[model samples]
Target: MKFTEEHEWLRPEDDVIVVGITQHAATQLGDIVFVELPEVGTEVTKDDEVVVIESVKAASDILAPLDGEIVEINEALPDNPALVNEDPQGEAWFFKIRPSEPQQMDEYMDEAGYLALIS
Candidate 1:
């Protein structure tokens, strides 16, 4: 798993990459109430605003960490947004993307670095 400065996490799974916000991000958001996910098959570039999350505190955008095609989104989020707060790095993952440039993942930090960043 790799983590971005924006608090997004990416886990390579088979041929795709699973993407989601870190536990730190979910805690900061403060009780997510809504989620707007990108449609599957949509093309995205690095830093593109792909998912919108609304919480009691504020609404935030989840950016694409790499150029890729959004192959699947977690359909459960729209109905149960609180899942983000419940299991941010697990079942609450936002989407799976097929990266056009898989090597771009190397630019992200490891778990230790991410922990240091949050600390």
Candidate 2:
């Protein structure tokens, strides 16, 4: 898994990358009440806003970490947004993307680096 400075995490699955916010981000957002995910087939560029999340504290957008095609989304989030607060790095993942430039992932931080950043 790799982490971005924006607090997003990317895990490389079989042929796709699973994307979601880190636990630190969920904690900062407070209680999540709403989620707006992008369409599965949508094409996205690095830094594009792909997921919108509303929390008690504020609304935030999850940016695309790499150029890719959104292939799948967590359909459960719209109905149970609190799952983001519950299991941010696991089941609450926002989407899976098929990266057009997989090597872009190398630019992100490792777990140790991310922890240091937040610390």
Please report the candidate that would top lDDT against the real structure.
Answer: 1
Model 1: colliding residue pairs: none
Q: In model 2, which runs have C-alpha deviations exceeding 4 angstroms?
A: none
Check candidate 2 and list the clashing pairs.
Answer: none
Per-residue alpha-carbon lDDT of model 2 for 15-117, expressed as tens digits?
A: 9999999999999999999999999999999999999999997899999999999999999999999999999999999999999999999999999999999
Q: What would the C-alpha RMSD of candidate 2 be, to one decimal place?
A: 0.5
Q: Model 1 over residues 63-91: C-alpha lDDT tens digits?
A: 99999999999999999999999999999
Error of 2 at 76 (Å): 0.4
Error of 2 at 92 (Å): 0.2
Give me the overall lDDT of model 1: 0.98
Give the worst 10-residue stretch by lDDT in candidate 1.
56-65
| Residue 19 lDDT in candidate 2 | 97
